[model samples]
Target: MRVSGEKLDDQQIIEKIMRSLSARFDYNVVAIEERNDIFTLTFEGLMSSLCSHEQQMNKRINSTKLEQALQSKASIGGHGG
Candidate 1:
């Protein structure tokens, strides 16, 4: 099956996607109202985890970019055209 410009294989792919999305949406819609009912929930912890993961990813990406830039600079500076 195909969705817009994307191809979706596997049987019931559309249904599965729709169902999962709908369930997530519904949970989000009701989460705020039922916050008190959800004990042991740590939004702060979740945000901290996400922030740490993002920082590590950014560091890795920047290191790779810096290495590439240095290599390119060396190549260009060492070669006379």
Candidate 2:
């Protein structure tokens, strides 16, 4: 993930990014590099998991879409209605 801010300092930006990521995913900061005002953060999933960040993000998106679909169906007299 890349996080950059014009007003916030590097530490502040890192903290905010970490908080946002921790809220949704289980990960550890594997590496951090800064160049040209951009902060590049590399994360590794916990428990020696093999899933990449892109895969995890895709799963979260798909799960959210499924939940929304289920809710819409239920609201319209479908399953669980």
Candidate 3:
């Protein structure tokens, strides 16, 4: 998914988002690419953060990834891909 930002290329933005999602949810984000400003997520990833939810059984299994896909650049690093 894409967040509102400027200058960052699609790949860079996607990389930052994927890292945050992996960290925040503790999920193993296997792969992340980009298409325009939108993103497609693959499922079956794990997230420890969701364990505390009252409704332990999340109907949407992929929500953890969706939740992790935030709309902000926490940070950017390096010029090399």
* Highest TM-score scorer: 1
lDDT of 3: 0.40
Q: Which stretches of candidate 1 lie over 4 Å from their true place?
A: 1-41
Task: Assess candidate 2 and give its TM-score to the true structure.
Answer: 0.37
Best by lDDT: 1
- Model 1, poorest ten-residue lDDT window? 9-18
Clashing pairs in 2: none
lDDT of 1 by residue, 8-74 (tens): 4442342343244434245432543365422333445434544565687679999999999999999
Ten residues in sequence with the least summed lDDT for candidate 3: 41-50
Per-residue lDDT for 1-81 in model 2, tens only?
245435765565555655556533533443322232224332232222324665878898999999999888788876444
TM-score of each: 0.48, 0.37, 0.28
In model 3, the clashing pairs are none
Pick the winner on TM-score between candidates 1 and 3: 1
Candidate 1's displacement at residue 26, Å, is 22
Clashes of each: 0, 0, 0
Q: Is 2 or 3 the stronger prediction by TM-score?
A: 2
